[model samples]
Target: MNIQTVGVIGAGVMGIGVAQNLAQTDHQVILIDISEDILDKAKYEIRNNIRLQSFFQKSDNRKTPDSILEKIDFSTSYKLLENADFVVENVTEKWDIKKGIYPQLDAICPQHCVFAANTSAIPITRLASLTKRPDQVLGIHFMNPVPMKPMVEMIRGYHTSETTIEIAKQMLSQMGKECVIVNDSPGFVSNRVLMLTINEAVFLLQDQVATAEDVDKIFKGCFGHKMGPLETADLIGLDTILFSIEVLYENFNDSKYRPCPLLKKMVDAGLYGRKNGQGFFVYQ
Candidate 1:
């Protein structure tokens, strides 16, 4: 499939970044969300980031902030996706939320259009089963801050077709991203490993074995990691990290995947890291 227009569901951090990146590549985007407030906030952030990026990469003249802003069609209606050549769903990771959206997407989108789930842990096969076009559904697990991440974790469902995978790769390539295709499984690969490391980091904090800074420092200093596991969790949002850990624990029925109590308490207190300004370490 030759994708010209892309549909992005949800107006959260990942959704906004995905829409902004697609727009920066000159693809028309239909950015849908249930809340107008969230849509407005997403639009503001996209504009802000585009301006910030222009200063850092002066050589790239692909888009100005105004051009990127204009390329996107923000809407509250899911039916607006009817004209999209491809759709990327980046809703919250909870099963109930995702379950509700897939059927609506299936009903609204054209039969030939492909559905890509931007989830970290949910099984692509399960999401595929919700729609009539099972073979057309797959996971394009984009990393947080979609514009900065050059690599995407592509997941093939049990019934996902080779044609679908090829088209997915083609679409991502157009946006200047490389795909690492992996077979469907719980958390696939990235989150399965990443979430565990973050969870363990939280354990270290809970046990008072190390300060959050020290724990991240060890990994950064010794292992040459770009970001500490706890810091990564904070960037990903503590609530989201907690949710993924729960999914991993339930899927594997293992204690190793259990979420840290401190993580849950932080979430309960409404401190979801950079988004909310607090998590393991406070963000100004």
Candidate 2:
């Protein structure tokens, strides 16, 4: 549980953010991705985010851009992760994609390394079953802005050990984050409730109950929520929302988890929210 080095899989939004979070704490980080181009973009974004933070906020362990960037090793190979003490996987949410990686991770990583799945709705128990180290597999659901978020949803699979949970908490403590540990279920706790609200907001849009702006305003103004469900969906990505909802519906066999048609159509049209500039609303 010393955790000197960390390995991060995927270079998308969450992957990059997680790498930045680890690097900012001066942890030696190995970030792996299939594309060098995407890796480059992730590095640039990490640097940009760090620079913005330095200007806007004050902290005790603030790192220079060079110092923070120096801690990270961006690679196109999984072999670089062999020495990592902990590995966080933030790959796409598709089951097939996860099935492919978990087996590979089980084979490649050191025997003692723990695998944390940064998933939205996929059950930790299911992912754990795919790997040899079921007791070492758990969920560490970091929010969108990993560096800024203080709370991460820590999930314990059916076979996960108490020692693994404590080690995960220690690692999160190093990054100045607290884990809200919860028992594993279909969507766990966060997405099970949040996704339902987001899907219902989509239903409102589908039924033409109100404009997106009005719907979001009602939630923020009347309910005193930070972001509306439709806006949250946009931030989470329509495709991701649809995938999580499908997983919920399939697991529970309930009609309440059904995805709104507009959500599917938006994803089909390639409008994936802030990452692409369009979802429930235009980004810019």
Among all candidates shown, the one with the greatest TM-score: 1
Model 2 per-residue lDDT tens digits across residues 3-29 = 999999998889989999999887999
Least lDDT summed over 10 consecutive residues: which range in candidate 2?
Answer: 54-63
The parts of candidate 2 lying over 4 Å away from their true place are 59-61
Taking every candidate in turn, the Cα RMSD to the unseen true structure, in Å, is: 1.0, 1.2
Question: Candidate 1, overall lDDT?
Answer: 0.91
RMSD after Cα superposition, model 1: 1.0
The local distance difference test score of each candidate is 0.91, 0.91
Compared with the true structure, the alpha-carbon lDDT of candidate 2 equals 0.91
TM-score of each: 0.98, 0.97
